[model samples]
Target: MKDRAVLYTFESVHQAIKGEDVLRAAGIACEMIPVPREISLSCGQGLRLAAADAEKSEAAWRQAAVSWQKKVHACRVDGRYRYGVEN
Candidate 1:
């Protein structure tokens, strides 16, 4: 499979920060980033992590009661990013 990354968009800044905390607490590496233009226009905050960590990140957030508004798949090519499927 192609190397993939995950993008998580939040409904608010608080949720984004909470999500990052949850992931980090669970030992999953993630970073806060700008929500992609294709995702939404409202919240500008999101989280980025390797696709390998997606499942663990999801579990961490749910277990910690951290809510995210959307999850998107990102394709990384030649160190550049292109939008992928949104869930």
Candidate 2:
């Protein structure tokens, strides 16, 4: 949804997949999407998450099956996803 605030950028697609698995198992609502060009063209995928669950998501990611680059608190400003490092 447009209100969702953060996108967790993984180091790699594999890591993003692992993150998806972990969040699913932990009951966090999220998905693996192509890493938006706005975030980073270098990465292939990212995990979109609800802004409200950010704190819990952080814990979930810590227990993820793999690692991520770090999460970004993304806000769609002027129709673009503007972001900042969340760690």
Candidate 3:
């Protein structure tokens, strides 16, 4: 199996939920994932998006004018992990 993930953080939980809604409306598959411990040990909500859809997801967020802070990291779960471009 192969999987990709992206983390999108917001200043507040409200913004995070709102952003999720916008992305869902745009037909982008996303889920609320725990903020990676490496990025921030603090417990907060973030978004997990498929790596294959990363580009389209970012584009949708921009088009929706959703205020968010995002970090795009690509990793291969089945094989060796790696980081990719940040959008």
Candidate 4:
């Protein structure tokens, strides 16, 4: 198995859902994950993808003209969470 990465975050669930549809339409592999507690304890969701595919996913979202407030972050799923730049 391989580690995964988070692609983007939206201010509301509706935006996240719409973004998910756009990413899927663009042929990007993505799923909705609970927003990390570090960011918010609320039930907000975000899009996840394979770390290797993060860049492509971001580009696809941009090309689709989706509006998102936060940038993507690279995350490793080990016991320890590591954060990196969007790329």
Best-performing candidate as measured by lDDT: 1
Candidate 1 lDDT score at position 29: 90
Task: Predict model 4's lDDT versus the native.
Answer: 0.70
Q: Mind giving the per-residue lDDT tens digits that candidate 1 earns over 1-87? A: 455788888878998888888887788898798887777877579998988899988888888888887778887777876667442
Q: Write the per-residue lDDT of candidate 2 for residues 10-49, one digit (tens) a residue.
A: 7778888888888888898986778767668785888888
Evaluate model 4: give its TM-score: 0.68
List the global CA lDDT of all models. 0.82, 0.76, 0.71, 0.70
Which regions of candidate 1 are displaced past 4 Å? Answer: 85-87
lDDT of 4 at 69: 66
Global CA lDDT of candidate 2, please?
0.76
Counted clashes in each candidate structure: 0, 0, 0, 0
Q: Cα lDDT for residue 13, model 2?
A: 81
lDDT (C-alpha) at residue 77 in model 2:
58
Candidate 3 backbone collisions, by pair: none
* Top TM-score hit: 1
Best-to-worst ranking by TM-score:
1, 2, 3, 4
lDDT comparison, 2 vs 4, better candidate: 2
Ten contiguous residues with the weakest lDDT in model 4: 78-87
When sorted by lDDT, best at the front, the candidate numbers are 1, 2, 3, 4
What global local distance difference test value does model 3 have?
A: 0.71
Candidate 3 TM-score versus the reference: 0.71
